[model samples]
Target: MPREHPLLPIVSLPFRRAGRDPMTCRYRCANSCAHPEPNASSTPYFGEILERSLSRRGVARAGALGLLVVGTAASTAGPAAAAPAAPPSGTTSTSGGRPGRPLPFEAVPPNTIDAVVTPPGYQHAVVVKWGDPILPGAPEWDLHRQTAEAQEQQFGYNNDYLAMLPLGTGGRRALLVGNHEYANPELMFPGYTGIPDAAQTAVMFASAGMFVVEIEQVERTGQWRLVRSGQRPYNRRITTTNTVFELTGPAAGSALLRTAADPAGRWVRGTQANCSGGVTPWGTVLSGEENFHFAFVGADEAPESMKPALRRYGFDTANRGGPSAELIDERFDLARHPHEANRFGWIVEVDPFDRASVPRKHTALGRFKHEGAATVISRGGHAVVYSGDDERFEYIYKFVSQGRMDRAKSRAARQRNMTLLASGTLYVAAFDATSAAEIDGSGTLPADGAFNGRGRWIPLASDTTSFVPGMTVAEVLVNTRLAADAVGATKMDRPEDIEPSPVTGKVYCALTNNSRRGADANPPADEVNPRNANRHGHIVEIAEDRGDHTATTFVWSVPVVCGDPQDPSTYFSGYDKSAVSPISCPDNLTFDSTGNLWIATDSAYALGGNDGLFAMPLAGPETGHVKQFLSVPVGAECCGPVISSDGRSCFVAVQHPGEITNSTVENPGSRWPDGDFGKPGIVVTWRPDGRRIGA
Candidate 1:
């Protein structure tokens, strides 16, 4: 049975008091501390100042001067203006209804293939994978010759999120940020046991993590390959053992985050099991900490008072020894690092431009089984991020920062903007699906042919205020689940990836799969969920009130009910069911240049085929025109599914390629991307004719 933690605690941290005198340097000294004022002058490069600050105190003269100018300008600009009109909605259409001819290589085979395959006319290749030499002088991987020291320097495992940022002037070189969700010991170890074996455990531990590599585009082939030589300055790795993360935002350094390793509550040892992520307009990567519960053990022995938040985050409350404990750090042992579990579930930000940069865990976003974080510019120019806690009966959340974004992606501007997620307001969703009066346990369309309704933002915390009334801001952000519950937020069906439509300003959330709704204690079906015991979930479209992401009210609708289209309970916005591909357990989502939504599936039920990537024209007559584009090997889930800005290339993460019950490396259930043995990896697909992907 799934564990249910109580809502997180809520406490408020007062903003720093204003300093006396206009010319006094109020900037504090700390590696992860916020600037006293947004306008305080700062050095040209934030990385340089941060490094200097880590070694000593005092602000750089140049930085202070720059801040002065910014502060002066901000003071004159006054408060931010209201949001502009939303962009017109795009047309939804069937896959066959598009005017352009379909690419011959748009779909691929359904097999447990050992190589990266694409449609007939498309090209596919590996961009990067676990243990690939990334940094300078990094030794090549030797499967049997693994070491924690070497693993910390090489690319990590289970690449889930992919983002390529162009480097230099011509865009030939780029930096790649990928998430290492978790390691499959059966595939990663030479000999493995579910039981804890120190040596075997070390190898598995080293492999379970995230990687940041640098690569350049091969001009002739339009393929991307790792830059194996040169400084490759941007290449780095964030693993489970050595990487250090700074805490920021509302819950930063709060009592809940205090641990023996970080009694100051300012830093964490590493980033574990990162999953789907998003890129900020400022050129930074925002990675979600997903499935973090599995990395720890002994939640059952934690102080009784701490169990609620643990249960809310999916930690086993009855058993102190969690799944595969012997393979993980003993700090996970509540007997040791009692507060360790509290450190794993926040959104982590990495600035790829600074190779020596420390990734930060932003606490204002709240903690849960985060799948992905998507950002959009609010009417106030503040950054608004949407996230989902991927669990049955979990909730969807959003964070709006106090600082505005820098529209232009300059180095200095990007540095300033990267701090946007540090301080903000966090909210959970509470919806009222009124369009469907008779939604009753069936996945049927409402009388209006939609599961649409109004909704509220249900504020959890804002800068220094805890909206739960009885809770404090720290408690709200640290133990946010509790605060969300206190306010009666609506429970969702395993909300997975929540992303905003860059073109529409509306947000889309994938409610993956839920088999608990309508259960004795669970909530009954509503228009939005529409079905009790939802198996294959649906897509939710939310239009923020007045198109302002910071608004507390909004309108929502279920645009797509996922399942075999032939199922009467399922509806595809009236599109032809026979023409659409069946999809289940929608896990990750991405949008193409044309605004079509691409969905990747995990755990396809009764589908009788490998999980695959699918695309649908979210707007036109083919709005429900879902088509399978590519499938992963048996037992593997298609994740990431990132389409480049130009739409020329699509990258997907083939996770746990050979995952299977009782499967071992010697007798793998599925060998993929490599014929000998399957190593989960990231695959890049591009059109041979040089046209945009999915065109």
Candidate 2:
């Protein structure tokens, strides 16, 4: 295949999308859980102080899966059965088998090491990694002499969320955008020096952001390499140290976002803590800035009235020890610059095709710890985006754009359509348990026997109106969780990644474990979050009324209560309890073209093993059959799993391998993919025979 002109670089264009509505397609909101989970693959973010307000805690151990859950049903039996992908529509058995003739592969047990473990017939490789040159004129990586200038042009650190959109609609070339959630200084720097000098801190600042690059498939093979043509035009990096982002929606110029530098509050210097994100039909990528407040300290000297809001956001003025960000950037000292914290936690949008375009933060979608955004078109053509606040006890939200998706691919048309998210109606979820009284604060089924419910998307604010009394439209968008609280949204068990099924039009959310369930250190178990002190979380499946993407009313049920099946508390779509792979702490989620749901786990609590990826059929005979496709290294959390357009290759971002107690660059626990210092990167796994991934 012949390649066209090299892709253009990311140019920064400025346009306020607030009123730009010309029937162009619009985008939606998304967020990622930037703050690392306890003893997670990375370091601290907002940390546990926020846990107080979050009012939550426990996860199942990674190993000892069966020991944790005792007396339920055995999942790993003596022999195994063939599990095949159920036909998109058919009458297949829940325990799928036989018709296709052979099973894909048996589920692999959890292991502790540093390798991209895959099925026998599959092959894998590292695509792009930290320190690799991505832009023109970038110097080769030199660990001993690292600098912000060099880090800016190289791949940013801690690759988390990623999106691969076809380049020019061609199958051979595609653009990949990955979110560098945050930098692991200990792992990056040679001697493991703490954040001390300005030079080193600048490196940290430059590494914590996002990077966009183009990739091409090898001649007639599944292997893809970074397009190495003259200065990759589309290759660029958006970092906390330099790139500028424009704020959109109701809160664009709000006083709360105004800083000494950006008094207009319409633009911020950069986006930090970007986590898992989504792709829009209009051809742009959406990234969620999560726990951006982690880098700052709360304002103790601010007006008393503003204290509660600051604390609610996990901001505290107390200096915990060691070199602090406040020493370098005053904006981190909330007492000196309080509003700077408000500028983050919004779903940010970027146009991958045009490097010159400015990234945008859609404030209409509210501010919170976002797990990221996923969108689906409504029956009426409206763009409906789904996002979950990654904090435990927070709520899941959806934004319905006023305008419909404009399939026109012209540059002008796409620009106009991108503003759809800038102005829309945002709603929070509220669940009504069918069996309200049966919940006895234990991880038990209600009188109705299942943790099922009827729920409604409570409208919190529209682009122009605020449903919450006393708050303005702008205020509602900025203080979304407060507005959600005021309107009685359901407090979930650490709502994480959520997505709508392309084939079924149903929405699924990963409620990462909230140790604070029944006696959750706070609220008791509700029908939606039924487990008491839920160690292993569950998957909540939502079906909008009449399959409408923007439907206000919906029905929901717990499809998979995760944990060791032997433990009496687990549930897996009521399928044979003995047949499912044990999974816990579901984080990022995505479905293949065939409609099979692929789940990436953040915490392997139940099995005491490395976190891994699981594939479950969402329709027909294999609806609840969960199979472990692959597992990451010893301490890495699997993230950003996206299937190539052809469905022949699946790429998963292995974040922070070798992250463990006492593990650092000098003393690595796992030097995976490359045996040296631990680095976060993406890995592509494909079948040797060119079959579909997970086949």
Candidate 3:
């Protein structure tokens, strides 16, 4: 029989040693529990576990659950039929799929320990890079001839998130917004040392980080290219020194947001370390501020009372000085700018359609180490956004707007739609399992057939109200973790990317590996995280009641437990273990037109292979046929696997190229898309015959 739920040990069953292979034991237990009539409280949880186990055994939940529920009904009605065959690979159809054409690339290149390269019949290009020009009369980039003033107007380094939105007319032009993540002085500056003053003032300026450039796109032969020169009217640059963003939502003008520069909390100087982001249906761009902890210092010396909130947010509780005190910018010294850290870690929204629009930082989303935000339009027309805090033991959050969506697709409607995100209610998830209470640290199946349960979205704050008893709405948004703590929200294992399955409207979250899971004396195993030392990670599926994205309660399950298929703890919706690609450290996620989920990996453990992108169907007979679509080279993470609206092209960002140890420009380990040296860049892949990608 399946084991007990992790959290409630009282419901657990004794684990048996079934030979050397754990997969066999897991499989056998699931198959044996095909038909179980547990109590009502445990039925739902058991059903989820059973479904997961059967899925790993290659049995569809509908078929397995139907058999369990109806029993001899099928036999009485008619003779049992053979199980349906799995769909042929590459047979799925997406929006751009058409007849009589081959796929973009037959398959991605084999796993590599180095940098990025595309399959044959595909080409990659660097649209823009650090120090590139974005505004009129901007000076060309000169690494050796650098100045902070010039760097302020030039493109920033380490572009993470990218969004391209169309401008007036039939897609002839567009605006591209790119986030400048943390600066890599060693990689960006020549002859760089820890010294504050470098040979290149421009490099120092670039290191502060900023958003730059709006390139005009020229419609080419069915593709788009950046126009080097033109009437570029909407082009603008937002840098670390001069750009001002307004505070909105719950934390706007709160005391926590106050700084020497903005005592009233109305404005902040600039955005920093922006990671991944989303584009709203209303044409605005949402950028997530991540890893803002390293930008400020001096928390260690602050009063003891402030330490709790700082520690929760990953800020230094011991020393307050940023990541590296000696090498960091002087501005990060908390003694110099006590409130600098508070200015970051927010979801900043920019109206790309309006050049003069001042971006607003929405506090309702609750600040932490934000990875990204993905929104799903609720059945009731409200927008529901899912976000993750990329720190171990952090929590996942969702925001549901009170305003309904305007179905009209007109420009005026789009303008109004952008405001939906600014006013919303934020919630954190808390999961509960129903099962035998005997399951302990071991990764075992629960008696209820699954490590599944129902969960509630505990509200933290709304437009003008706060659900947190003692804290104000501003406190709830600014120091969100404290608020979540008060409400006892369930902590998760590094929630990375939370996205909705376009086909089913069910949400999928990547709970990236957490070494701290099942730590000797910390937060122990829970239903959501069934494994003790969760090293390989898993995928969480949340289905809102009646398919309502704004629902307060929902059912959840772990569909895919990522690891080597040979490992018994790993599960893949019952697909043949040998037939699927081994995956780990799932981070960013996107969906193809055919409703297939594409997952991107960041850090790989077990030295299994290179980080890459994997695709699996969320519906149909081949729902769990996970396959490796692409891989990145050494020292790089596969990010931004966004398929085009037409499905004809797939774009991925190969970040931190040539990031291997003890390697420099003179002796780079991998010279990727460019032969001379490797530079992190965005790659586009399309069929040679111009057919839909992934066919």
Candidate 4:
């Protein structure tokens, strides 16, 4: 259940005839919802403990804090964009993290112990991990009594958001998939058990979820691995306690998704807490069920128009004792099951190359906590996704898809572009301030001098209609954050991982920091999250409209506020923030086929320790320059950075390696690619002569 799933069905879909559709694209927010704080994973997902519990929403420009942003990725490409690949013999994107430098190596530095470092001619490996095997007659990992049928054919646990694809095009083999995102119980339960029977809770429900396998490309030096010897049939794994999902758009079989074993809300079994994902031009793999309210518990027995979105998406209603907060099943006790936590925060997708097909959950892309799903295809080939709801203030979404992307690679064009994410239309963004009354909170640059502006999107449901008014369209896709808080939207900051910009379709999000936006947040410092307690987290950018990747309206800004450029807030676009490379919170992003944006960081110990992977150069002169090529150890969190379409490998994942707090599994804090405990795998990184990691 990587990124869980929902939606109902539709099929005959070949880019179904649609109309203008393509609005919403930001997480929900108007009133409450977004907490973060408590760390050392009891389940917080997303890193540096969500940037030291949401980086204090900082910017308001305290003292001429700096920011003039302008845009461009290959750092001012001059040749109508992405058209300058001729340098090979040695290399050069320019310097390290600013103007013209697509991370020309040399930054790195942040450390902790236990490792996976990089940079300095790059080289990383590990590929297939956690229990390994993955399909083809299973068995192998036997960390003691582990057997949910041998952790369902192996390789699951931690590894977050990845993709790969390839398969044909002589790229040497691909598929890979990934996104296990949860499961560490003292290193996959060995003697470190608080009390777990029922077959070690069914091998901790088969180590959380999502797998796929298939790798290859070994001898090329961009190194891959796994393709385990033979048969392979696409390799599978699903998880959360087996697997079964459907729930398409307009709220599938709504009744808030009937549960007593699928009372027919379309079907739902498990999908674990998958985090981060996306990859679908016409080859499925969306995933996003981020921090699924740590599995269900629904306090206040919901129903009061769904009790303010089940207490603003932080469920787990009572039953709060210990044993690592157990609640095995009672449908996660939401007073005996309250809409199975509305059948999980969705955006599933999956198809990798159809192992046996069937895997959806679209709900027109509403239900929050999604934090992943990138797409971007419209020149009429419809598709356009892009999500982010990794808690705190939530609200950023997008879903277009009324089918349409048959760039034929057949298999009925990958089963009609995998039903283009079930059905579409489901916006949500608002930002309109050139200086909303001169944003106060102070972090400062709004005399129209630019915090940038104009944003729209709105919608709320459409695949069958219900522009949110009084609900229904399955309560606006199962309470999509109270239908973007009854239509006001806006609130962002903790957005986390948005994408789109293979070569400037310009989306790039990662607001990843928002220690409550001050004025006592609930609705504070707007101007599209102008920062108040916002520590170090920024990078907005948008663009849309004429570059219409669906477009409802846009023109955003922010170009990297992230921190440490001698702390006068930090901006990067006007370049010279001492030449970029401090970064913080930014979270996952991708984009290099030439648009260069990489980035990873989920917490930045001020500018010292772990959490790394940065690149930036969205187009010439290092657009909002960033640099650090790779870091990741002492309690990891760099998550699937993907990048490999001949760009020469890059992968990532490494989540929760040696997760922290009391260590465990025999005193382990992080052993990295290996040493012991703390699993979470997949690394890759390349450029050992093959070139192109940061070159």
Candidate 5:
């Protein structure tokens, strides 16, 4: 096999425990791993509660298999049967595997190759990339001479979330919306040690936000190309330099959210650290603002009343100076404007169809380092959203709209449905384990032979109502972590992305690695997060009671405890472990039309290779059989991971390619898509024969 970058040398550097290189840790999340875990509250870990509950209930190991409703058919009994053959038309299944089809393509083997390695018969290509011109009148990208103006007009940097919505029939054209998570100047500049002036810092800020570009599907093929030279009216750029977002919900105009720039507390200048996101049922996009705390300064001088909330969100309350963004935008100066930090860290909703529409930050979602917001309408017609706070020992949250969705296909209906997120009841998750006595922080199966249990969604706030004592509705939404801590929400191991299977209505959460688990002063592993010093994170499957997304109660299971197949601690939903590809640090997740779970990884160095995308069937005999479909180049984290509506194409954002400690643009680590200097971008893969992606 030919190497992706046979001429370029692959530099090996020491990485932090999060599996991210030091440079990625610094720029992407402000070296969050280096700081002490922010969740110091005494809320019992999920595993501890599970253990105590089971002790009182007594052991009932036999017939427990009857309770597992995951992908198994009720009539079949025992394990799920093999999926039936695909129909002659070869369309993908959208109902979460009610009529499941078999996985077709053979799995790709793991390797350290510096390229976008795909399965046989599949082809991949770079779509819009960093510095690519999306807006008209934007100058071509120059590697050496980057200007703040040009960066604002061009594609933003380090694209994370991706959403492709069809514009016409047969998927001929669509709008491709991407989230620019953050910027790495060391990889962008020729010799960047640090920002020397405001101009350079402005360029970095302009490169961090979101971009919407129109793309056309290649005639008679599964691939799609960017619409560069046409009447692309939707092509737009949103950056920290100029884009202003509206603050909505109960806390929008509260005194705690007000700042000098916006006395009404209803508007914010921009968004940064826009990580993984989801495409809403109404065709809008929801982007998570993860790690936004890193951009601010003067937290130490902030008022004593706000210090605890700020510190709980990972704001460095000890820091006193040196925030380059404060030079251009005074909002970064938290001491002068302490409430400005509250203006950020909310779930941002954007309309991809309306370029002129102002994006909104929904305070009802309950602010935190949101990993992503995936929505699934409840059986009752209300919109149900699931989000995870992306930090060690944080909690998972859910929001149920007070109003039902207007299903009519009109601009007014869309606008009305968009307001659903603005008024909702926010709830945090509290899990109860069944086999607590069997769990010993060894990642081992319990006496019942499964890591499964019951859980409930603990309500925190609704409109102007607060459920927690001594906190108002505004305090509950803005200072959510403290409220959850007070209410005894279960602590999770860095829950990143929570997505519901459109087919089964079963929610899957990607629990990224937590190195502090079982360490001194930290909680130990439980059934849901069943690993001590967890390097290879696990995936949790949640089934709301009676298959209702609006239900407060649920049953949960850990189907995939990720790691090398050879490791005894690993499990893949009872499938033959030897046949599964090694996966670690599961990050962003999506579903192909066939209801197969598609996972994009970050910090997969635990598996001794580059991070890539993997597909796993949720139903049939192949359930829990993990297979690698594609791998990004060296030093890049696989993100976005939007599968086309037809399931013919898989799009992933290859972020921070060639990023390594002490390597500047002139001397990079990996030359990926271009085989030149490293530039983060989006890549799409599909079979040349036009078959459904990953079979």
Candidate 6:
């Protein structure tokens, strides 16, 4: 038996507040849920595979015709996103089903807690909060007296997507890189109404970007703190207000990317709306620019030829009257600078070790509403990156660098490896389920006992080369979503952070909930996404062909269909339902040293509880056993989960606490960590005895 935790009670609220707060939907993602899905292409779902598979010879012949030839203008005519003809039909395999190690900690129960809840043996601390003074000579944070200059020197708001890279040996020091995804003006400004003034807007822009701070481990424990002492050279702030980022790759100097300010199109001012990211093997970081469509105005008045690409990227073209960043920067006004919108939405690379290093945006990675960039080394020594376009009925993407990684430790070698992402071939995913005939959109398991499938990576573009027939290299890179749609890629349900396990090369993606799944002509439920009106999303496991990261073909299966275990719709890799904890809305994903999957949740209140972090063994007897490791504060979503290389500390970014509708700084809904206001911050959790996490 477990003792009851003395915290906030589990209050029953209406289903409306269960998922995302209306205020969060507006501020975080520009009320994206309220708008129609940008991807309106007539792409076929997995159910079409059954109809095509009736004739093996015809299916094989069509599969070959479906794949677009890379490095050339070879292409397909219609909606035929089939697999390569060489692979066998319905070929799939499963892993991690045997007996293995058991989870040691007890699960935490769901609650509307105003504090961070952890398993009994584990402990947690607030590592750093938003608006803390990170740079030297920076004044303390005062919500009422905030200025853009002061905020530029302080830690920004809404810390998300955190990673701690080793600074030196012995784990005593490390560098922490995090993203300030977006700003919540209602929560930041006291007595705030709608549409902030120039000063307030400037402060908000200054608060949104990326941050790098030096952190030191405490006494060999998992606890770490920001270095507030002498000569912290690594403490730098890259905000949307002033940071200059360089443009790289084939699309860098294209006419579409050029603007009146530069004309050269070789440089950009800043990176905004950075979500989740991954630390690369070459000792740098790659952050994705997400939800950038909300930052611009005058798109309705843009050039006639540009309206299609703009609307396809979620731009509000019909509404010309709205307050946006155009007031601060003319580049945001698409009517005056239609080409400026093309500059953002690329993968940004930052070298944290060099203080004077100018960050670069790689154009080879197709531009979209990127969730994050996770990289792995392929069997053929190429750099493979996986990213998700986070929107309803969007597609997943991959990039394979043509250049091999330089393994030498010299600075010259590091500089050479930095250019790896600048030239790569971009591909999109298309799935074909084996059990398509049994999918009834009711979350029922097929006769094969699992939702498994076969899939392929459809090439879209390469460096200075166009695989898409009509689009040029620059057009394919800038208008990537359009090219993917042209190639008939599979539309997924808000694919978020995608990661490849360090222990196993298998890739895992969090297909976060899509309320519109099967609702009114949206893509119906298939094997991978096995639920209709999927409130609690599921996890996907993909094994590349021949264990090669750059392979075009792969096998996939849904290991966990997250929801209440009592619900017949939920599936947990054949685990005992009574033994697993309920999980909803899986978002960010990471892995432990032993290959256990650590999942961070966003908008998990759909299950009538606060969002939380969960751990599930990927293989063995406990493979599908889900355990709740920690629960965030009320009205908050968990993001940017990273485990230390030593396997002792786990870091999570708590974002947008106390963001309930109509709540302001004057009367906040939940006061967490500081007892005064709800501030988004990074937290570190570990065992008191300093044992390996989840040991």
The whole-model lDDT of each prediction reads 0.66, 0.69, 0.60, 0.64, 0.80, 0.80
The TM-score, computed over Cα atoms with residue i paired to residue i, of candidate 2 is 0.84
Count residue pairs with overlapping backbones in model 6.
Answer: 2
lDDT of 1: 0.66
Q: Estimate each model's TM-score.
A: 0.83, 0.84, 0.80, 0.33, 0.94, 0.92
lDDT of 4 at 338: 72
lDDT of 1 by residue, 391-456 (tens): 666789988898997655345565677788998889998776543345677887755556676677
* Candidate ranking (TM-score, best to worst): 5, 6, 2, 1, 3, 4
Using TM-score as the measure, the top candidate is: 5
Worst window of 10 by summed lDDT in candidate 4: 17-26
Clashing residue pairs found in predicted model 5: 50-433, 95-503, 96-503
Model 2 agreement with the true structure over 223-294: per-residue lDDT tens digits: 677875686778889988688898998888989889898999999878888888887656567888876766
Q: Model 3: how large is the Cα RMSD against the reference?
A: 13.1
Name the runs in model 6 displaced over 4 angstroms. 1-18, 53-99
Instruction: Please give, for residues 41-75, the per-residue lDDT of candidate 3 as tens digits.
Output: 11123244434444444322221100000000000
Go through the candidates in order and give the clash count of each: 42, 42, 36, 60, 3, 2
Root mean square deviation (Cα) for candidate 1? 16.1
Ten contiguous residues minimizing lDDT sum, candidate 6: 68-77
lDDT of 4 at 479: 72
> Is 2 or 4 the stronger prediction by lDDT?
2
Cα lDDT tens digits, model 4, 1-695, are 01111211111111100100011010111112323321111221123222422342343321111221121111111111111122110011222222244556788765554677776677777878788877888877767757777888888777777777666546677677867866655556656655555566567667777888888888877989888778988899998666788888768887888978778789787786787877664455778887766544445565555655676666533333122212455676565667887888888877756677668777778787787777767777787787878766667888787878665434566566667677878888765654565566565665545566556798888877798777778888877877776776666767887866543456778887775556341445655576677756787877776777788887777766777777765666577888777777787776555546677876564454667788766556566667788777755678768766567777888877655545567766665565666677887878768876665
